[model samples]
Target: MTEYSEISARLAALSDDQLTVVLQAATAGRPAFWAVRAALDEMAGVGNVTPGTDVSPATAAPGVHDQVTGGGVSGQVGAASTVPAVPVHPAGIPDAPAPGGYSSGGVPTFESVRDKVEQRFGTAQGMGELDRQTPAGRSADEQWEAREKAARERLDRIRKSMHDNDTP
Candidate 1:
């Protein structure tokens, strides 16, 4: 692509508003920011534009034409330009998380740590007092006592029902 400087003459076709949009985006170090800037400066001069306009292409000093795109817009795009310039993989879309955490400063990040550390004080169903509402069956000691009593009663009934085989 031709540098903005090479295309400065062509920019005259764009209206004042259009020129402003290009200038705003180009300040982020888009290729040919200097050329867009030069066009704006020329418009300001020819149209008797008021100083109220923020056309102060701070990246490009008056008469200091650094035609290189990345020069004057140093730090304009900042860390964003650090993203990989390669096209997205054509094979398939990446997973939602893309593996590591979203740290961009060379460090891979993991998902937010949300350990499901649960603590139960009294019962499994609910909080201490609330557990009483749920019928969780008899306690171990109570169940054992009830079971033993039933067994003894059953044995007595069986003894009464048994025939005296020794006597026979």
Candidate 2:
């Protein structure tokens, strides 16, 4: 009679295999559905926290437990848990690797990449690498001249193509 019952009838009509497929997909990409979350909690022996309910870490232990699979949760689960925090410096973060250019005690640095990017974009007259495809060992002035020539050539080609268009 009602919309809920009509939708229920449609779902009830699906075979077991079809229902399983649908439920699996719904559980994965469609967690907005409260029913799917409830079903997940039920299967995991955990209580269902309603959608939009703010269950902070402090209060979640009594009513609900995060059902984590694949091994088990050690200390990453709950608040007030004893887990030491490790400080990491910027130098500790691994940078883009260069074949012969690792600095700071073999911890790769970003200086090489920074230099390349700056050469390519930051400089006024440096070909940096790609401007006009200049051969190796070209001066910055030569590279800029080649880049300017390439731009003019490309512009001429584009203009020629536009004038020779068959459409109009």
Candidate 3:
């Protein structure tokens, strides 16, 4: 038997589930999947293709439909009749939810959230709210210098750890 006939026989022998699995495997991560889809889309008259002056419909490969008219090679020898295109909706597919509204429970309004935040921290009255106060003995400059020294020490330890293969 010819390769085409063999393929047709194998396809005909596959069960519905087996055919779906085969189709999924064929399309998964394959570049040809998009090409076939584009060809189908062109055949279904979904996209327009600019006609090149170089190649005409007569020169196109057999079974390839003309992009301009969404028809098979017009009057070309060995061209098959145009097959009726059916819109394919895969089984178990859920209809997409309409836009502009939350699907789940109600969300808090931005105004309400802003009002709560303003009520909590929008005044200078709540300024001294820290758990630990700054050192009373040290001035601001001295405290900043101490922080800088601590940061430098920590950075030096990290640099030493990165450079040294074995720590002393």
Best by TM-score: 3
The worst-scoring run of ten residues by lDDT in candidate 1 lies at: 80-89
lDDT order, best first, reads 2, 3, 1
- Show the colliding residue pairs in model 1: 101-109
**Ten-residue stretch with the least lDDT total in model 3:** 95-104
RMSD values, in order shown:
16.5, 22.7, 21.6
Model 2 spans > 4 angstroms off? 30-168
Model 2, span 1-168: residue lDDT tens: 354466566667764434433454456656577687567555544574565565575664433233332333333556342212222224556644547657646854577767777776767455444553565545666877899999999999999998899566
Compose the digit string of candidate 3's lDDT tens values, residues 1-168.
254466667766754434433454355577859776565544444456654434465664544232233343344688653332223436576433224332223555455667778877755345433312445534665777999999999999999888896765
Pairs with backbone N, CA or C atoms under 3 Å apart (clashes), candidate 2: none
Greater TM-score among 2 and 3 belongs to: 3
Alpha-carbon lDDT, every model: 0.49, 0.56, 0.53
True-structure lDDT of candidate 3:
0.53
Stretches of model 1 off by over 4 angstroms after superposition:
1-61, 65-140, 144-168
Supply candidate 1's per-residue lDDT for 92.
60
Would you list the clashing residue pairs of candidate 3? none
lDDT measured at residue 15 in model 3 versus the true structure, 0 to 100: 46
Question: Candidate 1, overall lDDT?
Answer: 0.49
